[model samples]
Target chain A: MMPVEAFLRQDAEAVRPAPALVKRGWRKLLFGDVASSLLTVLISLCALWAVPRVLDWAVFDAVWRGNGQACFDAGACWAFLGAKWPLILFGIYPPDQQWRPIVVVLAFLAITLWSLPERNWTRATATGWLVVIVSSLLLMGGDTLGLQPVPTGDWGGLPITILLTVLSLTIGFPFGILLALGRRSEDRMMRWLSVGFIEIVRGLPLLTMLFIAAILLPLMLPDGVTFDNLSRALVALTFYSAAYLAEVIRGGLQSLPKGQEEAARALGLGRLATLRFIILPQAIHAVIPPLTNTVVVVVKNTSLVLVVGLFDLLSAGRSALTDPDWPSPYIETYILVGFVYFVICFGISRYSLWLEHKLSAGVQR
Target chain B: MARPSPARESTASASTGWRIAQVAIVLSLVGLFAWLASNTAQNLHSRGIMVGFDFLWRGARFPIAESLLPYDPTDSFGWAFVVGLGNTLYITLLVIVLSTALGVVVGVARRSSHPFASGLSAVFVDTCRNMPIVVQLLFWYAVVAFGLPDTDHASHPLPGVWFTDRGLYFPRLHLDGPLLPGVFVLVVGLGWAWTVRRRDQRRRTETGRSPHAGRKIVAGTLVAAVLVAATTGLRPSLEYATLGRFNYMGGVTLTPEFVAILVGLTVYSTAFAAEIIRGGLDAVPRGQWEAARAIGLSEHQTLRLIVLPQAMRLIIPPMTSQYINIMKNSTLALVVGYPELNFITATTINQTGQALEGVGILMAIFLAISLGASWLMNLYNQKLGLVTR
Candidate 1:
C-alpha cells in the first residue's frame, strides 16, 4: 500500500539518531544560556528538595503488607489496601455474590476495548453491547436465573460507576441526536424547544441537577409513585449528558458540508433517508474524538455521586475506611482511588488523541 | 455566509407528514408537562407543604463560617443566600485570575526550548488533568487538616506565614479611615497607569525603541499605594498572626476547607486552560517566528508583537468556556463544607422542607450567572474574532 518515496521517508525517520541528540539535549538544557542555566539550577534544587521527601513518604517508608498495626506509624499504609480491596471494589454488594460484579466489570471492559477502534464497530458490536448491558443489569440486580435478588440500595464501587456512565450514555445519545437535528431543522417550534432544553441544562452544574434528583424528585412525584435514588440520579445524568452531547453533535452536524444533504435531496431521497444514509455516518465519524472526551468527563464526574450519599468508587473507598483496624490511611485510599480514576480517564484521553490523529491523517491524504 | 442552497419544494404528502410530525412532538411534550405538573401539585398537597418563598424571610438560625460581607446567626435565609453567593463569587473570581496566570506560565513552560522545563510541565499537566477534582479536594483537605502539624507545632514557612492544622495564616495590613476617598483615588491611579502603559506601548511600536515601561508601572503602583495609605491612616502599619494560648489570634486565615477547594480548583483548572493556551501558541505557524527573527526582533518583542496577538484569536473562545467552568466548579466547595450556593441550598431544603423552592433558587442563580457571563464573553469574542475573506 505504501509508495517507495514514502517508505524511504519512514525509514529515514526511524533511522534518526536519538542517543546523541539526548546527550546534546542535556547539555543544551543545563547550559544553553545564562538564563537557562540559572533556571536549570533552580529547578534541579527544587526537585532535589521535593522528590526525596515525596519518595520517602510514598515508597521508602511505606508498609506493603501485613495487618494494620505495622501501618500505624508508617508513612503510607498500603497494606490497608489489601485488607479493604473487596469492600472498596465491590462495595456492600453481598460477599458471596461478588463474582457477579467481577464478571460484569470484565465484560464491560472487554467490549469497550473491542469497540474502541472505529474499524471494529459493526452491527455485531452493537448487538453484543446490548446483550452485555442486559446481562450486566440482570447480573447486578439478580432475582433471575436462580440468582438471589439484590437491592439497589447496596450498589457501589466500580460497577455503579460503570453502570451510571453506560446507562446515561445509552439513554442520552439518541435524545441528543434528536435535539441536534431539531435545533437545525426548519421548524420554529422544534428549534425553540431544543434550544431551551440544551441551554437550561448546560447552564447549571451537575451537582445541582443531582441535588434535584436526590432531594426534589421524590417530592415532585405523585403519591405512592417512586424510584430509587440511583434511578433518580440516572435521570439527572441522562438529561445533563443529553444536553452536552447535543452541542457536540451539533458541532459535527455543522461541520458536515451542506452539499452532502443537497446532493441526497437531488437524488430524490427523502429527508429522513438523507439523514440516515448520507449525513449521520460522516458526522458521527467527524466528532468521534470529542465524544470520547465527553466520556472522560463523565467518568470523572461520576465521583460526585458521593455528594448524594451514593456509593460510587470514591464513596466506596471512604466507607472502607470505617474499619476499626485501619486508623487513618485516608491519603493512601485516596491515592489508590484517584489512581484508578486517573488510569481510566488517561486511557480514554489517549485513545481520543490516537483517534484524532488517525482521522486527521485520512483527511490530509 | 448564507446557506449553500435551498431545498427543493416539498410534495403535498411530504408537507402533510411534516405537519403531523410537528403535531405529534408538540402534543407529547405538552402532555408530559401536564402530567408532571399535576403530580407535583398532588404530592405537595398531600404532604402538607407550603410551597412558596415565605420561608426565605425567616431567620436562617445558622452560622456561615466565613463571608466577604458581615453576617450573623440572626440573619434571614435570604441574607444567608446572599452571603453564600458572595463567597461563591469571591472564590470564583480569585480562582479565575490566579489560574489564568498559572495557566500562562505552565503553557509557556510546555513550549520552552529547554527539554527539562517542557518535560516537567507535561508531567504536571498530565497528573493534574487525570485525577478527579473531588479526590484532589479531599486529599488537600486531609493534608492541611491532618497531615500537617497542629497549631502547637505549626511550620513558619515565611516570617509571618504559618502552616497549621487549623489553617494557613499570613500577615495582613489593616487600614482604617475614609475608605471611599482612598478607593476613588486608587481607581484614578489605576487609570493613570493604564494610559501610561498604552501610550508607552504605542511609542515603542511606532519607533522600535525600548522603553522602561515595567519600571514605570512599578513606580506608579508604589506611588498609588502610598497615596492610598496616606489618604486612609497616614501611618504605615503591620499586623501579624501570633501564637495565642489555644490558636492563632490575628492576621488573615484561610481555613482548611477554603484552602483545599481553592488549591484543588486552581491547579485542576490551570492544567486544562494551560493546554488550551499551549495549543493556541503551537498553532501559530513556524514561519511567523522565523519571519520575526529575520526582521531583527528579539524573542520577547516577537512574542509580544506577533505571535501572541494571533494566538489570542484562538485563545479567547476556549478561555471563555474555561472561565465559565470555574464559575460552575466553584459549587464543588459544598463537598468540603465551604458554604457556597449548593451548600446553602442543601441547608435551606433541610430547614424549610421545601426542596422545590431551594433548588429552584439555586438553578435560577446559576442560570443567570452562566448565561450572563457567556453573553459578556461573546461580546469580547466578537470584537477579537477573525474576519474571513
Candidate 2:
C-alpha cells in the first residue's frame, strides 16, 4: 500500500484555499446560528431586565428590621419576617421552649444529610435514624429530662411537618411492604383485601381522609373515650402513605422474575426467609428512585395537615399573616415559607436523580 | 411417592387446620367491625347526633361566590352539592385543556435546539413542580386580590373586559338571530367534509394516487357555512360588562378565588405534564427519527406523522394519571373559597354535624370521578395499544 503521507502531500499541494473566514468562537456563540442565536439573545435580554428588579425588591431594598415601617412600596418587608420568624418556626409554642424545636429541626437535618450518601446507608445508619427520630419526638413532646410536657397541639411549624412526614414514613414503610406482599400473594382473599384497601384509600383525596380523622373518627369512638387530633391525623397519614407506597413496592415486586423465588424455594427456603434474604433486598434496591419520589411526595403532602387546622409550616405562615402588627407583608412570609419547602423537596428530587444514575450504572456493570 | 402415601391422615388434618385458621381470622375481623359499628351507634345515640343523610334536604343558607348552575342561598344542601360538583367539573375540564396545551408547548420547547428555550422550560418545570401547591394557590390568590386595581378604577386592558380586585369580567357572546339554521348548516358542512376525506382516503388506498382534497373540503365547508349564515341573517354579538354600583352586570364574571384556583392548578399541573411529555418524546428511539429523515420528510411532517404517534402511546398512560391528579388537586380550591365539592361538603358537615354522611358523600363523588376518568383513559389507551398476532 502506498504511504498515507504521499497521498496527503499530493492533495495538500493541489490547493489550500485560504481557510474561509468562518464565524467561529464568540460570534458563533452569539449569532452564528441565526434562529437559535436570536432566541438565546432574546431570552437573555428578558432575564437581564427582570432579575435586577426582583433582586432589588427581595434584597437590596428590603426591610431587614423593626416593623417594616421603612419599607418602600416596591420592596419586600423582610423585617416582618424577622419579627414573625419565631412564630412561623415554632407556632404558639412557649418562647423559652422554642429551643427544643430548633434542636429537633437540626437533628432532622443532620440525619437527613447523613443518610444522603449511599455508602452510609448501613444497619448502623438505620439505628442512628431511629435514635434521632425517637429523641426528636421526645424533645418535641417534652415531659422527660427535666422538660415540661408540650402537648401535641402545642407542636407546630417545621418541626411538626418534619415529624409528621418522618413518623408516617417509618410506620408506613413496613406496612406498605406487607400490603405489597399481600397484593401479590397466591391466596385469593389476601389479594382482594389488599387491592380493596389500596384502591379505596387511593381513590379519595387526602383532605377528606383528614376530615374523617378529625371529625368522624372521634364520633366512632365510644362515649367518654377520645382521640387526640395529632394521633388521628398521624393515623390518616400512615394509611394514605401506605397506599401509595404499596403501589411503588408492587411495581418493584412485579419487575422481579419468578425464577428467583423458585430457586429459593427449591433450596428449601421458606416463604418469609426467601422474601427477607433473597427477594426483598433486590426488589427494594431496584425501587430506590421511586421510593425517594414517594418520600418527597409525603413531605409535600404533610402540608395538608393545615386543612385539618393543624399548625404545619404552611399553617404557621398563614397564621403569621393574621397578626395585626404585621399584616401587609404576606408576600414576604409566603416567599420565605415557599423557599423552605422548595429547598427540602428540591433536595430530595436531586438525590433521587443521583440514586437513579448510580443504580443504572450498577446495572450496566 | 411412598412418603406422600404414608401421610394421608396427617395431610387431611393439616388441611382442616388451615381451613379452621382462615375461618377464625375472617370471623374475628367481622366481629371487630360489628363491634365498631355498634359502638358508633351508641356514641351517636349518647351524643344525640343524627346518623342519617336527611339533612341534605334542608336549606343551605350560605352564599357561594361562584357557581356554574343556578343557586340561591335557600337552595337545599343536596342542590348546593350539585352546584359545587358543577363548579368542580367546570374548573377541572378547563384546567385539563389549558394545561395540556401549555404542557405540549413547553415540552417541545424543552427539546429545542436553542439553549435558552430549553433552559427556560427547565426552570419553569422545576420551580412549579417543587413548590408546595397550596403556597402557589395562596400566592396567586394574593396577587389577584391585592395586586389588581380597585373596583372603581378597574383595568380595562381590552375594550369590553375588566379586571378588578373582585374578579375579571369579559363579554359573553349572544346569538341574536337565526342561530339554529346557521348551526345546522355548519354541522352539515362538517359531515360533508368527513365524507369527502373518507372517499379520498379510499381512492388513494385503491389506486395509489389521489388528489389532496383536504383543503378543498375545508374551504367548501367554510363557504357553505358562511352562505347559510348570510342568508339566514345570523348575527352574533358580544354582551359587554357594564359597571354597576356594587358589582359588574350583563357579562360573565370570574371571581378572584376562581381565577386563582384555575390559574394555580393549570400552571402547577402543566409542569408535571411537560416533564411527562418530554420523557415520552425522549423514549422514541433516535433511529425512528433518522428513518423519517431518510425518507425525505420535513421536520414538521416527521414529528406529526411519525414521532408523535409513537410518543403518544408512551405519553397517554402517564398523562391519564396526571389528569386524575389535576381533578384531585381541584379540591384545593376550597382553600381559596371557590365553593367546590370539598368546600360544600365541609360546610355541610360543620352545619349539620353529620360528618359521617358528609364525608361519605365526598368520598363517593371523588371515587366516581376518579373511576370515570380512569375508565375513559383506559379505553383510549386500548385503542392506541399495539395489536399483535
Q: Which prediction has the highest DockQ against the true structure?
A: 1
Model 2 chain B: lowest-lDDT 10 consecutive positions: B5-14
Mind giving the per-residue lDDT tens digits that candidate 1 earns over A1-365? 77677746543345655565445567876798998999899899999999999999889999999987898777888899988998888899999999999999999999999999878889999999999999999889998866899888898899999999999998999999999998997777888999999999999999888988887677667778788878988998999889989999999999999999989988999888999999998998899999999998888888888888889999999999888877778888898899999999999999999999999999996
Docking class of 1: medium
Question: Please, what are the lDDT tens digits per residue for candidate 1 over residues B264-364?
Answer: 99999999889999999999999999999999989999999999999989998899889888988899998888999899889978887888888889999
After superposing candidate 1 on the true structure, give the runs of residues whose Cα lies further than 4 Å from its correct spot.
A1-24, B1-14, B176-233
Query: Model 2, residue A333: displacement in angstroms?
Result: 1.8
Quote each prediction's TM-score.
0.92, 0.91
Clash number for model 1?
0
What DockQ do you compute for every candidate structure? Answer: 0.57, 0.51
Candidate 1 chain B minimal-lDDT segment of 10 residues: B5-14
Identify the leading candidate in terms of TM-score. Answer: 1
